[model samples]
Target: MKAILRTMGGWSQRAPTCCAVVMKHAVLWCAAMLFAALIPVVHAVAADTSLTPEASAAKMAAEHLMTAKIEWRGPSSSPKPLAGKRIAIVSCCEAADGAARASRAMVEAGKTLGWQVNVLDGRGDPQEQNKALNSAIDAKYDGIVLEFVDTTTVSDGVARALKAKIPLITLGTLRNTPDTIPDVSWDYAKHGEALANYMIWKSNGNVNALILLNTDLYVTRNGQWVGTKNVLTDPKKCKDCKVTVKEWPMANIDTQPGSIATAALQANPKINWGWCFDACMSRVSRALIASGLSSKMRGAGFDCNAESLQLIKDGQVEAVCAADPREWDAYAVIDNLNRLMQGQPTVNQGIPVRLFDKTNISTLSDYEMSHGWQGGYDFRAAYRKLWGMQK
Candidate 1:
């Protein structure tokens, strides 16, 4: 040990001095080993807690969806239409743009099937919707399409339709019970996540966002609220993000969004992003402009309504998630009903959604922008081919 210490010390004068050198060397060796051992631990901590991985993932996912080429992703069934079939639509609210679009598209799609389609406006009243459903039932329509109306309000009428043995499907609504009714609904949660991702990617991991929701709709409660919360609050995905959620009653969804947005912005100046769950972006956009926040705060949501598209075109909003065109959605409903009429199992229809923003919105003509992503490819032709209606 003395000889080793002396060599390490380069020929120290005394044994005690050599011993001191040995002790110093021993301490340094232990420290080196400890540091080497801790290197992996340091990296592991960073891997577990760092925000880069989740942010990167969000960026890639958001970009892919933003630029994805739309096409037919639904079924390929060549189901022929039943002869002399009459279908009725019970619209929850003709005032709502989405319901109106669905009504128009359903009528058009019905013509392709050579079926007679009737629409009864619910006028945003549950009692009206119930009465409409009963009217359709009384008329003995072969099928009924419930548009944007919650099933809860028309449960009795739904039961009556079931008792009457009519094939009832829903458009832009969820199927509450499995295998009971076919619903041409959307993955609203996916829509919400797309919005969240857009904010994340645009904000670059520093998002202070406020999400507006209408608790009355199942689409908002079961999907958008859940999806947005999951992403914005996840530490792995967004380390420097703050999400504030506010509820807007369905009754006031159209009219009160602007005031609510103004209030929220006034309450929290740190919020850089504001997102509505649907086409209420019109009101929100107006509020932002009025508040002179269009340059500071960004807005986003679903339903590419004409006003929303114009806002996007004018750069008032950052982005919006657009679902399958109402035509595609209406045809999907018809396809589901056709399957039921033919005694076949109903399919999910796999409707596609895309994110639109300033980067790509200008490519669409005014008509196309008015209608949202008119099926990136020739989806109507494809659907017609699936129905064997393409002449």
Candidate 2:
């Protein structure tokens, strides 16, 4: 054993050059393997630290929208309100909070301008809306604002109004058809984009969202749904994001939204965010709570309803794209009608939308909070000034 050990030690001392060569190769191989492993780690770290250019731009835009001060971006045409004109508002559905607010605002705005405004609820039915439109025409209204009702649904009534030369404007028409009727509407696609940007910014672009939409409603299909789906699926904006769309009928709004959301959540446990086209987040919040994922999941919506705003206050909802300044919208529509009555060219009142969340919601007054107004601007006074009202 001693002889063998001595022989091995002698061999190691004599083979120093050969051993150094083998050790150098071994060290080089180890370093190459380490660098190869670190390639992905470095890339992942960089991905975690930085956002894609699209995402960065979207985040900045979202932040600006969320915190931007509200101002009256206007018609810029100072026209005196046409007095003694009777305006009829054929509301799509007063049961819906937004539609109700629009109707009420029109009435209030009309009164402010010394005009008589009458509201007829369509109750969310096309036939009922047709009847309301016919009734308004029969009553000899000087002007009519189709508040939240699609003109396509009541083409005959619209034709009658056109024949009667009763200037017709729309408060929230989904499609600006006939090329004759002007609409005072929030840029719905922009609203959707703002909501999408907010979601992207908030989730850091890693989003799996379930979006609820109403195919029957044009605003959802042509506006919010289009904007959200485009942003979420766009590779430039989000790399690790996906969205599932669920269509719920407007007639079944009360019951279907919750079940559809829950079923979607159950079918795909990967869904970490939920977005609704309008104020449907109120029901979706209950579903999120029931699933025991409310704390983990995020919620976003449009047309910030009082219920959904309360959800934001309670930390259940993450964000809302709010645009329903009822009185302001009403005044804008009235301004359009006034222009028509006075034979002046009607101006497009591009109402701006704002994103609201925990960060800036506290700044809203109680009235503003309830009615979904972005705080810090007096649109009512601005509209009055544009209408050439002394008060």
Candidate 3:
């Protein structure tokens, strides 16, 4: 002990005694052994916390001075620019609120990105839609988007699109499959339930809802209608119900208020509430007015467009189940198309759709008009942020 003390004193005298330096070196060596001893404990704790061994290994790897590390490359797919490519967009109808806004935003965005885009209006004809799709394939568009008329009709044409080696992006309500073609859309049933519940809650259970819907369009009506039907038929949900169609949506019926104004009036003398799975911009309000029922009816419809907002302003409509229609349409088709074009494997999340009330309507409308179909979601920023391209 005396000899060791004498040696320590000699070293301290020569080095001018840094106890911190000696302690740090000792602590590091001790910690190395302590951590090694705790590995089994760490493994147990990590497992109990539901972390896999691989993740635990990665965490340890991050603290190492020398590691065989691989940086995260990207999504199973890439989102490269679609510049200098022509894309074909198909719509169920040119006149409807959702289709029209999407078409406009897509055209404008494509122009900015230097891609040629052609929109083929199906005009509510499945046969015509198929024909236009055939033309798009023959014309050799780099990417083809199929907006289905019904849930199942588009599936029959999938083989044709696949055989051509062209990426067919199915938008709106579509199916889950093992095919290379990916789907893009929001949850339809949730949207329907949320809208219905909101309306029922707003009316205080005393009002009767006149449900005007299109049975043909799968995404718009068929899928949504199923949920709406469930709610309306529920004795616990809504009190009184009557379903009427001034003109079935997408019959290419001129937006004329004349044809169904009389029928709507006759269906019920005083409509406490009105609902349309449409723009419900002008004609429905007129039907209420023409039936001399405008003063009493509180109206709600799908989509938040300029005209819809105007109706809200004029107090002709209560509220529209306004999800950013432009964004819904754009993200539905564009995200997958971009993925396919760049030879990236696409991943679908249950597409997110948010309801817009009067509080947020003005902002959503402005955002859509200024930015195509993105619905305030900056795809470029979103991708970069998601990929950790930015901190």
Candidate 4:
């Protein structure tokens, strides 16, 4: 590597290049080369030692590119990285924990792709999230990614942003209106319906299914309420499988599901199947036990929380309808950001949903190690390949 020297108010010193030194002085030039070689080792050590994402990014850039800003604060900058861009992640579901991981990944990806990215957590509050959206639009970010908490009210923010000519993409849910907010998310209804079909197929139309349909009125705008309704209404697919649903509010899974299950079993003693929407898979299992019928029950749900995976291993639960929640959360937003940035049309990501049973649950012990959560996406990369990388 060559080094170019920029002298200021003193003796000449060589500027560093790819490992070559450019000092006029002969003795010092050899010394500089040794130092340059050592620089790589030093930075490598820093990368290993560093903990924070920002520090790691900076260290990586400094070592590899000789000049990189891992610290830019806005989208359009000297390096013009998406890392500097301001992104608001609006979530009503408990996708934050996973989405945060995605955000970290996005930061690294942005550093590589030359983006300055920041994520705003909206906590499922529509008005509060709306204010954040307005700020991003006013700041004139190169792109904006929005996750919806309320399907209807949030539409106003999308309309306003689009009216201001901002590209706004929704993640994890879709707004059917042509209000110009292109959303990239999984069609959640497909997941719900798939689970319903699988349960019916396994049971040969005889399983009494108790469904834990998560409340979306206070959570996300994913139409969980409507989606579950649609998925259950179809009979040709579900055949003779009897289905019942209870709207479980957030965090009450620990208490509410047991009562719901007890009553359902009391009213319908042959209830052999239970399905909770996401993380509360274990709670539903316990609910079955509370009903004094754990022996006859085989349960299923989404997400790979530690307790839930163990339930799968112990045979208390039949399978998990697992999705990479963090990948779903993070890229759901970033995919939208890219669409907005490029003035391209956007659609739902339709993130893949998989069924994890006992045969494969142990092999996925990484989820056990990782708070029972999965990170990799089967859909994002595939979609990227089909649609081309976002600008």
Clashing pairs in 1: none
Q: Write the number of the candidate with greater TM-score, choosing between 1 and 4.
A: 1
Clashing pairs in 2: none
Window of ten residues with lowest summed lDDT in model 2: 317-326
Q: Please, what is the TM-score per model?
A: 0.81, 0.81, 0.67, 0.60
lDDT string for model 4 (164-249, tens) is 77665655455535645555555455545455545554554465878766564422224433544454455544435577877765
Estimate the TM-score for candidate 3.
0.67
Q: How accurate is candidate 4 locally (lDDT)?
A: 0.54
Instruction: State the weakest 10-residue window (summed lDDT) of model 4.
Output: 72-81
**Lowest summed lDDT over 10 consecutive residues: which window, candidate 1?**
317-326
User: Which regions of candidate 2 are displaced past 4 Å?
Assistant: 1-55, 290-293
Provide the lDDT at 286 for model 4. 75
**Per-model C-alpha lDDT, please?**
0.77, 0.78, 0.59, 0.54
- Sort by lDDT, best first: 2, 1, 3, 4
Clash pairs, model 3 backbone: 327-373
By summed lDDT, the worst window of 10 consecutive residues in model 3 runs over 61-70
Which is the winner by TM-score between candidate 1 and candidate 3?
Answer: 1
lDDT of 1 by residue, 146-230 (tens): 8877788789899999999998888876645434777887677877787788788777789998877775566567776677778
Alpha-carbon deviation at 40 in model 3, angstroms: 60
